[model samples]
Target: MTLPSAYTEAPARRFNVGERVRVKLAFPPGHRRTPVYVRGKSGVVERVCGAFANPEELAYGFDGNPKRVLYRVRFRQRELWSDYAGSESDHLELEIYEHWLEAA
Candidate 1:
């Protein structure tokens, strides 16, 4: 089956490479894109993935209002995963929607 176009459009105001950002996870029974593993963690903005439809809306049978920005945030593996086995500089990149971020 084909997915909705709102899920595929590119973002217009994504975070710049090397910028610092924080992820905001929705709380209380919401299964979210921002992993629980990374909550309250600080990371660097690595790349922009651009805007797409909001996942929350789609979850409730509504066409999500798309935001204008998205980002690829790079966090240290040690910061996210408790049992991370890599070096201190080892990083993980997450494709985060704009609404999930704020200035850090």
Candidate 2:
């Protein structure tokens, strides 16, 4: 699928590379793109993945307008799991939509 031609300009972006952020802990009903594992976890913004139509909205057959900025966030493996036994440098990156993130 393609974005509407009217969406030529990119939407305003939020977080920036290397900025600390926290995933929202919300458990709103209906389709969601944010993973449960990352909820309320802190991470650094690895990079901006550009804006796209909200997948959660699209799943409901609604036009995802006013694109949401997408970001690749990096989280230490240990932060996501209290029982993690991996190296301290281990990290996981997830492409999360801006709506699911908040200032850390």
Candidate 3:
């Protein structure tokens, strides 16, 4: 059974502000929280948003124990899409878990 998000806490934190990182390209079944469009994309960490229960694990009815660190990653809008029509200065930011991010 799934537990409330407030029941657990992250045990560790990783990554840092302004660090270049890439999102892992994954399509695992069930309880997914990452966006497909951002997969395999590289971006910079804008801020460390502290740890929270792992949504990926929570979706499956686990405790989501040992919460994961969440980061505010910034990516160029053009990089996320192939057909770009917006201003070049446009950007997209997302809150990504540490497990979904890696050094670029």
Candidate 4:
């Protein structure tokens, strides 16, 4: 089955590369693009990877609205895990949707 165009259009971006942002600490149920481990964590917007249908919403069979902006966010491994074994320079990158983020 073919999805509508809204599912593939470019979303109006709310962030920029190199900008700091905080992921929402939410755990609302369903298929979310943002991983649970990264919730409530702070990171830098590494790149704006364009928009796509909101997977969280689409998972329920609805045509996603106002497409979500996908961003590659970089976070320090130490920040995500207090007892991380990696070096301070070590980091993890995640592709998070705009709605899941806030200005840091």
- Per TM-score, the best of the predicted structures is 2
Worst 10 residues of 3 by lDDT: 1-10
Task: Tell me the tens digit of each residue's lDDT in model 3 across 1-104.
Answer: 11233422334656767789999998888767788999999999877777888898788888887788888789999999878899998899998999999899
Residue pairs of candidate 3 with colliding backbone atoms: 10-67
C-alpha displacement of 93 in model 2, angstroms? 0.4
By lDDT, who's the top model here?
2
What lDDT, from 0 to 1, does candidate 2 have? 0.86
Between prediction 2 and prediction 3, the one with superior TM-score is 2
User: Per-residue alpha-carbon lDDT of model 4 for 1-87, expressed as tens digits?
Assistant: 112223333446888778999999999877877888999999998777778788887999989876788888999999899999979
Tens digits of per-residue lDDT for model 1 on 5-103? 333435356466677888875564764577776667778876666676777677787787764466778888897888888798888878877777877
RMSD each, Å: 6.6, 6.3, 7.3, 7.1
Candidate 1 weakest lDDT stretch, 10 residues: 1-10
In angstroms, how far off is 94's CA in candidate 1? 1.0
Count of backbone collisions in candidate 1: 2
The model with the greater lDDT, 2 or 4, is 2
lDDT of each: 0.70, 0.86, 0.82, 0.84
Q: Which should have the higher TM-score, number 2 or number 4?
A: 2
RMSD of model 4 against the true structure = 7.1
Candidate 4 clashing pairs? none
